[model samples]
Target: MPPAQNTAGPGREVLTSDDIDRALRRIAHEILEANKGPEHLVLLGIPTRGAHLARRLADALERVEGTEVPVGSLDVTMYRDDLRSQPTRAVEPTVVPPGGVDDKVVVLVDDVLYSGRTVRAALDALSDLGRPRAVRLAVLVDRGHRELPVRADYVGKNLPTSTAERVMVRLAEHDGEGTEGVRIAGPAEVAP
Candidate 1:
């Protein structure tokens, strides 16, 4: 593929514009191909960054295949197993529209897939919503170190990293539309 033209805007970026654009393009193709070109596709993105990525994916898919896909955001903090045990209380209020997930192909999108806990919580959240015909996972970055057996159906980038590295997905939606894009770095840089 030819080099991507990112055209990063104003804000500071965690990753370069070209890198994120390339990843999204690749992921868009993967998603369309995986599901037979975006028929009956519903993208449910985990809260925060995942929601941002999902929106980007939706736009990318629309541009790539001329399909307007439904996209929504989900908050799984309450569904998470470790929320109560953690030092800080997590945010909640998982929202799924009344559209009904029954008999539809639901694709869970996230910024980064790491320990798999988020995906686990997401699965739980989906259960409360409705039973879909099929459920698949799509992640922008899969930094290996999974404590659970979860895996992504479509991965944009499989960045092999040790336990100490943190994959940060900085999108314009969250970080104010900027020139820089999503990035992965050391844990020391992460506030958590």
Candidate 2:
């Protein structure tokens, strides 16, 4: 593949810490409202950053509903369609709450919704588990350009970008990048 063109100058901040917090708060409320309470609701993070976002959302839900939300991590490494072409990646642990996905409202959480490939792989991984009454998607940033027909049920922000640009989500918990925010950066050039 040819090198991707950078759309944004270097790295441009799209969301700050406060913005992220507010977005999560709104998403938490929306999740609660849609589910008609937190009963049988499961927040499954899609490894790495998604796991952190899930925990944050769970905390927000707990604060509002005064009920503990089941937060876990889902690793879709084996289920990824491009696994054969990519380098070997360390598989993260898939931790489902004591109550499996069966009959529960499973909310797949992720940091960014880019090509929708990750979400597709997540669905494939989830099928191996139990069947959920319903499956919803929650994403902090929805950068349009989906290769699959997947959409986020709860979105914090809708950021439109070109195929050459990349969205980078930096969280204090995972990134340790001294700031919690979202940035749009130009793609890195590969040497010929």
Candidate 3:
């Protein structure tokens, strides 16, 4: 395929819509295989785009297993360690499934896995909610920075990048139509 243009604004498209779909499908299959089917599986996406991705994954899982999988949004804003340093962000709602997270395999999904702080915050938030039998992390883009020692259990794409470069994930459900792809912008190209 030809290199994608930055119709979403600036930056070069690294993963097209088709690529993202394929990655999600593969991740869904991997999750099913790892857990030996979707039994007791709960998908909790970190809010904003993560929630949308979780719903998509649930849909994919339903297609494969012919059964519905519980999916919800997890807001980790309050649990973040850098709240004092970074600007305050609006805390989205945290919606757990009917049965809650207790004794289930919880999968936390997100768009970009960058400094690992968000995942760490998510771990803290998940603890406040309930203890799961197991917890796994899934990310659409894994940009290696690693301020913490966290890693994704299922990754859609491993896009190695410098600290100065930014990986942006735009989903139609959250970012509007015709802007559904992963883009990478260097220091000079990134929007302020």
Candidate 4:
């Protein structure tokens, strides 16, 4: 398929809607397999798109396991280290599922994984809530450019590119209908 235009100028569609659906389904199965039946498992999305993805993953998990999974949103705004340097962002609501995070296997979900700072902030934010038996990271895209020591345990797509480029994920759940795909914008080459 031809590359689609992104708002940030010339870009290419990395993952179509079908591709995203397949990837999420696969990630759902992987999550179930890794956690072994979803018992005591909690998925916390990092607001915006991640929250939507979490809900989708929970739905997929329910389809396979025939059991409901607890999913919620975790906002890491105040915990972000770059708050001083970047533009100020309003703090989003952090919702934890019933039973809390204590003793549960918590999975932090995000739309893209670039610099590890966000995950690090998430860890800090999560700690303030409650202690979990374990914490894991899941991302729809892992665009390599690590500024901190962080890695996603579950990734949908690994698109390596220079820091100059941007990975834009537009989900219908967040960006409205007909805008569902992952795109790379700016001048950068995707590593093989």
Of the candidates shown, which would achieve the greatest TM-score relative to the real structure?
3
Better of 1 and 4 by TM-score: 4
Which pairs of residues clash in candidate 3, taking residues 3 or more apart in a chain or in different chains?
A: none
Q: Clashes in each model (backbone N, CA, C under 3 Å)?
A: 3, 0, 0, 0
Model 3 lDDT tens row, 1-192:
999674577788899999999999999999999999999999999989999999999999999999899999999998998888875698899999999999999999999999999999999999998999999999999999899999999999999999988888999998889989999988899778
Question: lDDT for every model?
Answer: 0.80, 0.92, 0.93, 0.90
- Candidate 2 residue runs with Cα over 4 Å from true position: 1-10, 188-192
lDDT ranking of the models: 3, 2, 4, 1
Residues 1-192 of candidate 1 have per-residue lDDT tens digits of 999653443222445767877888888898888788887788888978888788888899999988788888878888889976884755746556457678888889998899999999999989888889999999988888988999999887788877876666667777776634655556555555
lDDT of 2 by residue, 65-107 (tens): 9999999999999999889899587799999998899999999
lDDT winner: 3
TM-score per candidate: 0.84, 0.91, 0.95, 0.92
Residues 1-192, candidate 4: write the lDDT tens digits.
988554432378899999999999999999999998889999999988899999998898899999999999999989998898875687889999999999999999999999898899999999999999999998999999899989899999999988888788989988878888988977554433
Identify the runs in model 4 with alpha carbons over 4 angstroms from their true place: 1-10, 187-192
